[model samples]
Target: MLTPIPLLIIPLAIYNIIAFLTPGVAWTSGLAEIAMMSGVRWTLTVSDVFLALCLFVLLFEVMKATRISSRSIVDHILSLLLFVCALIEFLMVPQAGTSPFALLVAIMLLDVIIGFSVSIRVAQRDVALTAAPDQ
Candidate 1:
C-alpha cells in the first residue's frame, strides 16, 4: 500500500526529467501563453502556484490514507480550497481561443473532487475503526 506513493514518484520524476529536457516548451511560459490565448484573465498568479502546491499536498494525503491514517483537517481544507480556485479559474476563462486554462482548471477540479471523496471515505473508515468492538 505504501508502495503506491513511491510508484507515483516514478511518473513524477519522469515528468520532471522530460520537462527539464524540453527547453522549447518552457512550462510556465507555455502555460501563460495558453492562458492568454484562451482569454483567461490573469491566469499566471501566485494563487495558481499555491493551488498546485495544495493539490500536491492533497495527493500525499491520499497516499497516506491508503497506507496508514485517514484524511486530516489540513487535507480537507486544502482540497476545498483547490476546488474553489479551480472553479474560479474555470469560470473566468474567456471564450476566445484555445485556452489551456480551462483544461488546467478542469483537471484541478477533478483532483479536488477526488480528494474530497477520499476524505469522506477516510472519515468513515476512521469512525469505523474507533467504534467499540461488540462483546
Candidate 2:
C-alpha cells in the first residue's frame, strides 16, 4: 500500500511549493554559516539542504527496493514515472531550471535505475534457487 509510493516525491513537492510560493528566492543564498577550524567560513545554502535531504530519502528508497513483493514492482513503476516527470519539468519549466532541481531529477533517475536493477537481481537469485535439480 504505502510501500508503492515513491519517497523521492517529497523533496520534489517541497521544491515546487517553495519555488512557486516564494518568487525571487535564491537557492544559492546561504542558510547557515559555520566557522571552520582553518579560519574560514563554510556556508550552507538552500540548495545544499535540499540535496542532503534528497540523499537521505534515497537511502530509504534503496532499502525499500530490496524487498521482493508486488508492492516493490509498483514502487519501481512509480519511481520511473517520477523521474520522467522531474526530467520533463527540469527541461520545460522555468522555475525548475535551477541546479538543485536538476540534481533532484538526477536523484530520481538513480532511484529508478537502482530499483529495477535490484529487483532483477533478486528475482534472478530466487529463480535460481527454486529451479535447482533434485539430488
Query: All candidates' lDDT scores?
Result: 0.47, 0.93
Which whole-number lDDT from 0 to 100 does residue 35 have in model 1? Answer: 42
lDDT of 1 by residue, 52-112 (tens): 6545754765565343343244444554565575456446633311233444454445555
> In model 2, where is the ten-residue run with the lowest total lDDT?
124-133
Clash number for candidate 2: 0
Top-scoring candidate (lDDT): 2
- Candidate 1 yields a Cα-based lDDT of 0.47
Regions of model 2 farther than 4 Å from truth:
129-135
What RMSD does model 1 have? 12.1
The TM-scores, one per candidate, come to: 0.38, 0.92
Q: Provide the lDDT at 21 for model 1.
A: 66
